[model samples]
Target: MYGARLQRSTCTNCNAAYTRRYLKVQRRVTPAVALHSRARQRAARRGLPFDLDVSDVIVPSICPALGVPLVVGEMRSPYSPSLDCIRPALGYVRGNTRVISDQANHLKGVLDIEGLIKRAVASVDQRREDYARLAAYLDRELLLADVRRKAALAGAAGEEWAEVAKFLDAAFVRADWKR
Candidate 1:
């Protein structure tokens, strides 16, 4: 009887098989790798082998469900915490690449933006109230009771202050509230 043809390479000891393919990680390309990529792109334009340069990254070696070596290629990059690209590539591929865009990240940015807007609106309203109050506060002559050293020097005063409040009030009124 004849042995089966060498379909792929596998570690005899652990039976870890690896195919030739790689998954491109969505990362900030480094200067060196960027240079390589540029060269490859140029070569392709000149009708040459597209695989001018190949990088590597050591990713999951085995399937989580079967424990069999999952054919995968590692991506070389300098950026940390970069995500995997969703496109089909080669290094080693046993199955289609699954990339889940972390909705949590978008939600976090949205939450942060919401908080900032709320704080800004509250501050703007306070500023408007304070602006109107200053005119009234200045009119009080004998200084009312139950108050200490009521002065208008802290904020909202002077020619520059008035100009700023005028501009900010108009801006606050027209500020986009629709997210």
Candidate 2:
């Protein structure tokens, strides 16, 4: 039984020590290796911390978005707007060409807007100046003449304004002289 027998490790749990041990492994002399074991040993081997071609292992795309904000022509309409539209509104600012005009046709609009405004304001001043007038008229504060006067004064077109007042005042004085 001891011939061709070999020493071996025993069960660790049993605390069994080998002293001419009970377990035995038979050793044989063979001239060649088996085809299966030889092929396995020759197989492609890899070491620890081996690198894998995980590029195709599942990755996301890194390309940018679809398209950029390619802006086109943002120009105004081809047709031009009308002149009347550009002109100022009528009633606003009473833009009448008053206090300056021609004589033949006198094509001037009498609405010396500012002068008219001045007169209107003067009417108010007359009211306030005379307490009796305010009471006599009924019940209302006298109007502001300064506002109308200033408006009338504005009738003069800057440099031409002073001259225009002289011309109009002359006309009024002449009319008064008839009396």
Candidate 3:
């Protein structure tokens, strides 16, 4: 029933004396207004300084952090635009505030630039170690396979040589020849 308020109006003309009921349209909450309000409330709750107005909150079409299309009025959506404090300690000041995706804001989670960089570097190092270990395992397996192949070939050659020697000995006995 929001924005459904009715107002009674009377005609000013002398000929008409009838009162008409008109619906008063309520103002829709724009992205800027919503962001400013939410940020103000959060700052108030956290006892942080807030100096942002509705005009100060500029919502971009795409989130600067994630490059995803920002949606308004979708509070629970990850793509919903959120007003983030670049420096939490600085509060919701004009220069400290930015409009980013809710997902990015949540992922950031109070992390400073240095903390984020440290985490990223650690993750990269872990992945590199995992890849190196996998490569070493594969190399060892290939080397073992090569050795097994060579051993089989050598075994086969030895068996063939024994058969040839036996055949020669039998031919020599049949011809009554001594070696």
Candidate 4:
């Protein structure tokens, strides 16, 4: 009975020590790699495809959506790497899943593609209105300049001469300033 107890104690302690050593080694990896490894393990357990290697794709350390450097941390933290699903409620497929910054992932969660499109279209419309106003102003200025030039060339009097002289002075001044 004593021999059997001793043997069991040695075996269990060795096994526990080995498990602890393995976990310690895993903990030494970077947070981004560790999180990705955990996701791959989960995908394997769920019978999903996860063939991509994190080392191959994440060399630059930049977030794809935000276009900034990656800050390794746990899930849902700003600048931290997080796994994103291309289509909501779908299993993790090889091509459909990607790692992105947590901030971008959270932003995407609140706004669908359609909502983003609507916002972009509205912004473009407002910009177009501003551009229309600018173009109208330029057109009127060009017409006035042309009239002044014509009147000056035809030897017209005081106000027309002054207008043409001012316009020419402005044009020459701008040209000199560029140089």
Candidate 5:
């Protein structure tokens, strides 16, 4: 007669159970990873050909435009890697895309090198105009004060100084200020 029903579990069964649990845990993806996957899927659905895998995309720690650190989020942060096409119409081709911040992408705006240079030159010209205007104003104000002082000194002196003052007034006239 069987004494007590012998109860035993095989090492193989226990090991298989442990392996399945571990594999299941490992398969779980983080939100960032999920977002990236969704992006790829969306791109594919749009009929655009994307050869690069999500694993290959490197998320930068900093926003290149704003010069601030990037935080992981569903919409903008994870999706912040705005794929830039160097040629502007390359259509998501590999090697043409570089990751940049959304703000940078917006600022870049149409990506015509000539247009960008023209904008930069215009900005520089405006700054120079402002600086020149201020300099001219200061120069005129200071020179006018100096000219008034010289006139007062000439008026207080004698006839001999009157000839000197005449010369001084001529010089002031040449300087383009009131004597």
Candidate 6:
């Protein structure tokens, strides 16, 4: 039964019983089978080359791109496992294919390496600008604090006045102020 294929007999009762048993024990589709079928269909529709086999398709526990746990058989979810082509122009070739989360695949859609780099650089530049602004605000607050300290020490005794002068001198030197 394991090695030989099941042949349909001329007995209608046997056929009916087999069909009933098959329907009752509905088998689950494996991830590799589903991914291979989808890749083949997509490659055909897009006129792309496809050489993937069911054995070649392997779903990892976590997405390599997003580092998130891949949820198998959860269609339409962000964390669902998806077969992605590293180079879309190369089609579904064995070396170029990888399993990533659906969200990571969607985020990478149609973008080449140069485009992705440009996006990353833009985000970094924006963050740098924000930090610069924050640093300027902090500098101003520090200067204001120095002024308040100087004002508080103005009513102190002569020796304390000398210390205030030295503090002001150091502050001016730090600020690169002339005289």
As for lDDT, the candidate ahead, 3 or 4, is: 3
Ranking by TM-score: 3, 6, 4, 5, 1, 2
TM-scores of all candidate predictions against the true structure: 0.15, 0.14, 0.53, 0.40, 0.39, 0.53
C-alpha lDDT of candidate 5 relative to the true structure? 0.45
Query: Clashing residue pairs in candidate 5, if any?
Result: none
How many steric overlaps does candidate 1 have?
A: 8
Candidate 1 per-residue lDDT over residues 1-179, each given as its tens digit: 12233643454423222212111331233323533454356545655434333342222322211122333223432211211221113211211111111221121222233343444355565443333332222222112111212222355344455455445434322333221
Model 4 C-alpha lDDT per residue in residues 1-179, reported as the tens digit of each score? 22224445568876666666565455344654665677688777877666656652342266544454566533335777767654434545443454656665665553444544444455565443433332332333345445554655644475677676567534422322110
Backbone collisions counted per model? 8, 7, 0, 0, 0, 0
Give the poorly placed runs of model 6, Cα more than 4 Å off. Answer: 1-29, 123-179
Q: Whose TM-score is higher: candidate 1's or candidate 5's?
A: 5
> 1-179, model 3: which lDDT tens digit per residue?
33223331332542122211111111124667756876788989999999987877777766555456777754458888888776678788755666767876775667665555555556665443433332332233334334433444556775665565445433322332111
lDDT of 6 at 24: 31
State the weakest 10-residue window (summed lDDT) of model 2: 59-68
Winning candidate number (lDDT): 6
Off by over 4 Å in 2: 1-156, 176-179
What's the lDDT for all of these models? 0.29, 0.23, 0.56, 0.51, 0.45, 0.61
The runs of at least 3 residues in candidate 4 whose Cα sits more than 4 Å from the true structure, single-residue gaps closed, are 1-28, 41-59, 73-76, 110-112, 118-179
Better candidate number, 3 or 6, judged by lDDT: 6
Clashing pairs in 1: 20-91, 21-90, 21-91, 21-92, 22-90, 22-91, 22-92, 57-74
lDDT score, candidate 1, position 109: 26
Question: In terms of TM-score, how similar is model 5 to the real structure?
Answer: 0.39
Q: Which 10-residue span in candidate 3 carries the lowest summed lDDT?
A: 18-27
Estimate the TM-score for candidate 2: 0.14
1 versus 2: better lDDT goes to:
1
